[model samples]
Target: MRGTIHVLNGPNLNLLGEREPAIYGHDTLADVEAMCRAEADAAGYALEFRQTNAEHEMVDWIQAARKDAAGIVINPAAFSYAAYPVLDALKLCDCPIVEVHISNIHRREAEWRSKSIMTQVVTGIVSGLGVHGYALAVRHIAEVRGRTK
Candidate 1:
């Protein structure tokens, strides 16, 4: 069986740690990707780590994951709240999706942030743990995939 999880990021995430150190922590996106690769390997799964600022690219990747991966852990970043195209593509695939946010959206400003649009579609959501949230989500993806097999 094909066993792999896709860790997809969207919009401005490439700047992760430096984006806002106080909010996102000091680990760059590359750092998080490396951590995820190790976590997936330890859990006995392969991973597809990708990031794109373009909405269409993200949608295309989500569509592609239908055939390429067993699960998806996506941190849509600035796209989470309003990118309908990306959300639609994600919903079309069977891969379990776990939405992640480094900073808790609920505790943030009144207008700058909002709840995830994919909340109902996601198997789980991990927020407020900074980069650690992605590690948790990846582990969950592996465990969930393991059982379904």
Candidate 2:
């Protein structure tokens, strides 16, 4: 079966546009979804977009993607630092995984914020490119799955 690409967002990301305009930017989560949907459509693939403030819910979605999705584009947000369960679920994906960050975590103030446990399993990472990163990630997933023209 042709599968869908899951675009998942983590904790506090629900606050996108209003959270931290200087870092996260002025585009809301809805804006990001529109961008991802457009890219997924342009690439001829179905999209499954979701955001969660709870870690278990995020883990549940990742596990669900194992069977339902072709690939994943995730912005783990605050969970990036030490979500071992999330990392474990990601390890079972058996498909391309792209980790995206709206702001450059490396340039952020906190040292711990710069590290991501999921990085070891992700196929690619897009950072500091703002909301455009999500679209790039969808394109990359499409390319990896040979779904792009």
The lDDT per prediction is 0.86, 0.91
Write one digit per residue (lDDT tens) for candidate 2, span 1-149. 25699999999989999998998899999999999999898877899999998999999999988865778999999889888999999999988899999999899998888898889999999999999999999988888887532
TM-score of each: 0.94, 0.95
**Top candidate when judged by TM-score against the true structure:** 2
RMSD of 1: 1.4
Clashing pairs in 1: none
Q: What is candidate 1's lDDT per residue for 102-136, written digit by digit as tens?
A: 99888988655766787868888998888888988
Q: List the residue pairs that clash in candidate 2.
A: none
| Ten residues in sequence with the least summed lDDT for candidate 1 | 109-118
